[model samples]
Target: MSRYAILLGAFAVAVMVAGGPSFSQEPGQKGPLVVIVNISNPINQLSAEELEKIYLGKRGFWEWGKPIKMVDLVEEDMNENKSARAIFSAMYMDKSLPALKSYWIRAIFSGKGQPPLVFGRREDVVNYVSQNMEAIGYVRMGELGADNVKSIKILMDNKP
Candidate 1:
């Protein structure tokens, strides 16, 4: 699938068909997030575009040929998925949700650009990331040190 097709699908699916990112704020917080990887993974950071590529299944393998395992929050009425959607929208895909979905529907049926494995809760994402060296996911900033996962700095706008 085309790179544009993949991106259009990512942010678009979560946005348009699902009513878009959740606008509600976490109580007394702005829903800050941090990307996490299993402590065993050697890489320490990722460009925003690299993340978008992995999550969109555009980059299928790491430099060492290890598959990049991706994780994500399942869509819901709660803030976790919402906050993720907001951050992903603002920092990554940058496409409207509806457009993202429409692209994916066709892409999937065509056997291209699969999305990440989705967990219903953040704890599940953390658990998955902790156990899999190739895993990558994000959580509320405070959830980082509480688990076996390590935070990976996301280079905002791919800046140095």
Candidate 2:
């Protein structure tokens, strides 16, 4: 191969390594956020509304009676628009970070519910989900490494 070709190949690999794996998104899927669940969980997909309910503490159990354990990423930087938490909040919960925090605060104060467990790193989130049979969480599409967890499709209404 020519030197130019070798250089280009190296660049491509660098980019992929820096950005994580490439994923082909499905229709109605928005952004790079991927919802993941423990491999033992029977759920294979979730509608956007259902995801919202689960994250917002409205849904507590899977249909088969297993208690739903939700996990979330820590807000690393409020100004980072592309952070996993921001994309997830916008896509699933339809709430900004501050708004979501406020919602959780009120929920906790009123004795209604609590937010999902939060972790600082995506690897930790993946590990937690893999270890807990009922756990569910979201991570950047390319960051889910080889783990005992599965990414479920999120069905969204496409109506304009």
Candidate 3:
């Protein structure tokens, strides 16, 4: 009886120490959406400005091909925040939620780029990312796995 109790305690301790699964996440918790591209894509590394330019149509063509289709989540997307923040911060701008509307408006009116094809939920974004070869989109980071989609590293503010 004492041995069983000790084993149970040890298991509990392991759970507590390991923090669950391959990535650190609480049970039932999810992460913000992430912007992912294909692994085979010619573009390996990009500055936020470069990413912004690509999304905004300021820059066209992936290194290996002509213009690639950029996917945007719809207005109601739940995973939009993280993706936006990652993109905007790369552009050296703030990504407060309120500012996003204005950003889209500017992009639309100026004809610099089109707003992303918005989706209702993270699952939709994930589905889209997994299926489309030319598609690049975002989903909650924690939600990503070794699925069909390949993730590109977004340049954090000043980090290399």
Candidate 4:
């Protein structure tokens, strides 16, 4: 009985110490969305400006001379976590999704740029990024696993 009590106390202490970083979380409890990129991409980090340029086609090529590829989920097919899309639009694009769509349409018609390669689902985007070296995109925190893709710490306004 005494040995069991001691083991239980130690287990409780361990749990209390480790609760800060959960190994996994359900959808609602998960952390913020993260910008994901291929494992071989040279970029280890990103800022809002760099992300904007790459996705907007203002930045055509990576530093290593590889063309930058932006993968995307279509607007209507966004995740159930609506706030994640909202945060992305608010951060990367000043305009709402509809306005951004219009902007892309104009860009395409003018031959100024092309919209990102679109996928129908988040997992498809993740799988594509995992397979392509120059690809970049955003995914919800809950979906980030030990895939071939990785997250670039997005520092906005010098804040992580």
Candidate 5:
């Protein structure tokens, strides 16, 4: 199928459609961000609450598993714009930075654990995940490849 078709289909099937130019365009034409994780990871097929806990730092590790490193691509840069936010929000629950920070602070004070590393760019997240098998992060799906990291289903779909 055409890339547009794939994106439209993804949006239709996905539970949440993030903000972006319509995914029905060429690969680069779409502005939606992509979320990713190690293809080998087995702990993430979790409920939205569990995923939120992991991403929000409310929960320190994978369920019944050791602490797994969580990573995020910073939004300060131009590339990690609405697309990134859209993808991040879809993966977890609420999509607010302050909420995330508050959760992180709570985690740190509670001695649960630290928040995932933050990178200045999307490529940085990919590189970090690529180098570490235990790392999990997100990026623009269009920019993804097989060499560095692999894309995981967004818990929900984002399109339209």
Candidate 6:
């Protein structure tokens, strides 16, 4: 088995011993969302401003010249109270769901760029990021387990 599988198994055991996993957090809390990329990706960190620009389609390529491929989780519903999508949107995109949708609509209408590929499941997002060297995506902290993907720190205020 791969090292990641072993680590993931250990984590599962620890969670079970600690009374199972708890996904809940207080309202307005941040940090539960993690950004991930293919293990081959050389980038280990990104600033909040850079991430926002990438998601907004203002940035197109990595510093090393690879075209960035972004993946996104589908909003659960109109009321995405505290989902990963909600947290990522509020923190990185700085827009509500409706506003982000409108931004994408305009972007596409003007042939500027298309939104990231959307996946309904966190596992799918992780899998895609792992498979594509240029891909980046976000997931709940607990959802990352694949050996082929690695989470990079998001620098806020120029600090990681």
User: Candidates' TM-scores?
Assistant: 0.74, 0.75, 0.58, 0.72, 0.62, 0.77
lDDT of 3 by residue, 55-157 (tens): 6557667766755666654424325433434433333333444565678799889877776566655567667767766667665567566477766776755
Candidate 6 contains a number of clashing pairs equal to 0
Model 5 weakest 10-residue run by lDDT: 20-29
User: Which of 3 and 6 is the better model by TM-score?
Assistant: 6
137: Cα error in model 3, Å: 1.4
Q: Is candidate 1 or candidate 6 better by lDDT?
A: 6
Model 2 agreement with the true structure over 1-160: per-residue lDDT tens digits: 9999999999988977886333434343344778999888889998888998899999999998988999997645434345567667866777777888899999999999988999988889999999998999988777788469999988898312
**What are the per-model numbers of colliding residue pairs?**
10, 0, 9, 0, 3, 0
The predicted structure with the larger lDDT, 2 or 3, is 2
TM-score result, candidate 6: 0.77
TM-score between model 1 and native: 0.74
Off by over 4 Å in 4: 1-31, 75-84, 158-160
- lDDT string for model 1 (1-160, tens) is 9999999889777786777554456664346778899998888989988887786678988787899998876535655445565556545666545556676687799999776787866788899999998888887767664457899888876732
Better candidate number, 3 or 4, judged by TM-score: 4
Q: Using TM-score, give the best candidate's number.
A: 6
Could you tell which candidate, 5 or 6, scores higher by TM-score?
6
Candidate with the greatest lDDT versus the true structure: 6
Model 3 TM-score is 0.58
- TM-score order of candidates, best first? 6, 2, 1, 4, 5, 3
Residue-level error in angstroms, candidate 2, position 21: 24
Among all windows of 10 consecutive residues in model 4, the one with the lowest summed lDDT is 20-29
What residue pairs clash in candidate 5, if any at all?
A: 14-157, 15-157, 34-139
The per-prediction CA RMSD against the true structure, in angstroms, equals: 9.7, 10.3, 10.4, 10.7, 7.6, 11.7
lDDT for model 5: 0.62
